[model samples]
Target: MPRPQKVRKILCPPAMSGFSPYGIPATDSEPIIMTFEEFESIKLVNYEKMPQEEAALLMQISRPTFTRIYNRALNIIGIAFVEARSIQIEGGNCEFEREWFRCTRCFKLIEGLENHSKCTDCPHFEKNELTRLNPDIKDRIA
Candidate 1:
């Protein structure tokens, strides 16, 4: 049996879901769907100027896997531009790397979205202080 896919972690999702080419009529053909992970790979490797190795580590995926994702993203983007087709960024096995805090009282981890100020199971549920979690890939481009 094939190995299960690892859930990629993205810091934040793209603001826009897709882009349509200007001066082109909407076509019946389906838009090229770019997975969130693919988008992330492009952003990290291209925009963020992160090395493939560190980007892969930040994504919690292997270097080769990250390379494949990056290549696929570039290919799809090129096709979208050449064909003047829309590009939709969505649909991937991913999870947002949201801030998590461990409760001091119960030692239970809580997500940032939940109302964690007051906990019934514990005496108090102060939210965990925010800290930089993602690897610093600024100069580690090896």
Candidate 2:
């Protein structure tokens, strides 16, 4: 009779216009595995100038949860910069509720839940995940 827990969506940095991807240097120090959802919380509230309440509502989380996520994200950013460490985004308890489509061939489940016209294991299926409905964003999180 218990309600199912809600899955938080990863909030990405506001669509940056003309921004290029840059890789941070990795170090011997352990990399922090901040989830995409937490990262989005910081970007929305801090960078996008959204109020905590508004951001929380948008994220479908309580205000306190949003605040905690935002703070954790900020801390990760600060540590990465101050320590000159590479930051790897990974390992969150969240689940993807998006329409997940199973590959008819390989039985691979696509996170976006959409069929990309081919199985992920197929040789010709590589157009880079973003273009495909089921992107492996988490696997490539670096």
Candidate 3:
């Protein structure tokens, strides 16, 4: 059986959100949902200055795939920044890790520090059990 494709992490804390200074507005009529995974690809390859092969491995994707994702991310972010339009993060092919929690009720995937031991999204989950499971978490410059 083929292994699952690991989705790269893209939820950058607001402080680290990659908003290019030269991003231009996207004029494409069909809207695209930019996944966080794609964002991480750009950060790893461009921002962190990692080699394409290394970045691809870190993100658990093939080098070509990583290149595609990174380019797409850069394109979207560039347009948003240049056009001054708000970028909305949405759906992608990925999964959350064990430490991460995606609230069933709210459908919010909370990414908190490991020390917190609780999701920032719905911290008061006394009724909802926090299942210990691993999800794909892409790293960024913290």
Candidate 2 residue-wise lDDT, 1-142, digit = tens: 5554455654332222111124643435566555666667767877789998998888777888888888988887787667665555543534344644444444454554245555657766643433322224453322
Candidate with the greatest lDDT versus the true structure: 1
> What RMSD, rounded to one decimal, does every model reach?
11.5, 8.8, 8.2
Model 1 Cα lDDT, one tens digit per residue, 51-119: 999999998989998999899999999999998889987767666677434445554545565544544
Ranking by lDDT: 1, 2, 3
Which regions in candidate 1 have their CA more than 4 angstroms from the true location? Answer: 99-142
- Kindly provide the TM-score of model 2 when superposed on the true structure, using C-alpha atoms: 0.56
lDDT of each: 0.72, 0.57, 0.56
TM-score of each: 0.67, 0.56, 0.52
How does model 1 score by TM-score? 0.67
Instruction: State the TM-score for model 3.
Output: 0.52
Better of 1 and 3 by lDDT: 1
The residue-level lDDT of candidate 3 at 61 comes to 70
**lDDT pick, better of 2 and 3:** 2
Better of 1 and 2 by TM-score: 1
Weakest ten-residue segment in model 2 by summed lDDT: 12-21
What is the model-wide C-alpha lDDT for candidate 1? 0.72
